[model samples]
Target: MTIHVIDTGFFKLDGGAMFGVVPKSIWNKQNPADENNLCTWAMRCLLIEDGDRLILIDTGMGDKQDAKFFSYYDPHGDATLQSSIANAGFQPADITDVILTHLHFDHVGGAVHFSSDGSQLLPTFPNATYWSNEAHWDWAVNPNPREKASFLKENIYPIKESRQLKFISGDSPFANIDFIMVDGHTEQMMLPVIHYQDKKIIYAADLLPSSFHIPIPWVMSYDMRPLQSMTEKTNVLQNAVNEGHILFFEHDPIYQAALVEQTEKGIRIKERAALIEFL
Candidate 1:
């Protein structure tokens, strides 16, 4: 099995919103903000190759939104979804499965794209089965006001329309992969724990977006239930530390992956390294 880091690009978000209750005095040290208090974040994705099945996890924000919409959050970078896929020596048609951590715009936007002349929406990976939980799928389609803006219909619906959507139960389909469900970030956000090359790697999707967010209290304000996020983080971190599991970060720009350890200041990142080191 081989794993490749697919960097779609980097974008900016309000540092305060990304760090929740954490004071700017602290998070600012980690991700220094711009003049407007927005910190640059990577729309990093992962592509896993196990035999013939090429699985893509969490497509980054696609380039389909209007300029006005993109002005709010600065999306800038050279890497794109297609380029990243090709970097792995494959194309969108090669992806057999797309495991979405959640349906937020940034995470799932690249799953679909606009057709020629921007008239119709189409699935980016026309041959792949796009994965999402039943619960989260319902929640995103009928979103509340707080999250409605993040859940855009253009990024979704097209998969179902294209007849390529698959819902994964919170269980392993094969010996190589397993799924974990967490609700704090969004209802039933699915995180994939893959048994790769004699090592287990957890795709810490919004649950632990970056190594900086490893601390229990550094939860994101965007989460619907902050307390639930704490519970999820504690449990996942504990298990990761116990087994020495490699954590694949989705949004962290600098650190690709890391190992966790219980420290003087609760659970903290032990070492940051590339995912290839483990493989």
Candidate 2:
């Protein structure tokens, strides 16, 4: 199996919301914030080449929102979903599967895009089967008050309308890949566990957004249930330390991946480096 880091780009989000109750003095040292108190984050996606399947995990937020919408987040950077895929020697038509961890705009926005003529919205990978769980699908489509803003209709409805969406349950449909369901971040958020040779790489998703979130208490305020998030983190961190799992971060601006160990001060990052170094 081969893996490529598809960097769609970087965007700004308020540091307080990302770090929950963690104080500015604490997390600011980790990720310095701008004058507006927003911190930059990477919308990093993963592309896997195994057998004939070209699977993309999570599509970074697409550039379809109007200027007013984009002004709030300030999305910036050169690399896009299409360019990164092409850099990996593939095209949108070549992708066989798109595994969405969740339907939050930042994660699923790139899955669909405007048609060339701008008359219709369509699946970005017209030939690929988009994978999402039924539970999360229902949650996103009929979003609750707290998460409604994150579940934008333009980023989601087009996939189902195009008849390219499929739901996975119980077991994963691909070889050497499995799913772990966690409800803390959102209902049934699917984390893909990729078995590569001797190492197991867990697509951390929002469950552990970055290496800075390894500590049990650094839960994101964006989460619906912060306490449950802490519990989920403890369990995942324990398994990562016990089995030597490599966490593939999705939102970290600097580090791409890391390994954790049970330290004197609970589970902490053992090493932080590019994904290629761990491989």
TM-scores of all candidate predictions against the true structure:
0.97, 0.99
Instruction: Point to the candidate with the largest TM-score.
Output: 2
Residue 217's C-alpha lDDT in candidate 1? 94
Model 2 clash tally, residue pairs: 0
Assess each prediction's global lDDT (C-alpha) against the native: 0.90, 0.96
Instruction: Flag regions of model 2 displaced more than 4 Å.
Output: none
lDDT at residue 121 of model 1 (Cα atoms): 96
The sequence of per-residue lDDT tens digits that candidate 1 reaches over residues 1-279 is 878899999999999999999999999999999999999988888898888888898999999999999999889989999998897799988889898889999999999998878889999987898888789999999999999999999898898899899787746554587988999999999888989866889999999988899999999999999999999999999999999999998888788899999988899889898888767
User: Local error of candidate 2 at 203, Å?
Assistant: 0.2
* Residue-wise C-alpha lDDT for candidate 2, range 146-245, written one tens digit per residue: 9999999999999999999999987789998998899999999999999999999999999999999999999999999899999999999999999999
Task: State residue 173's C-alpha deviation in candidate 1, in Å.
Answer: 3.2
Clashing pairs in 1: none
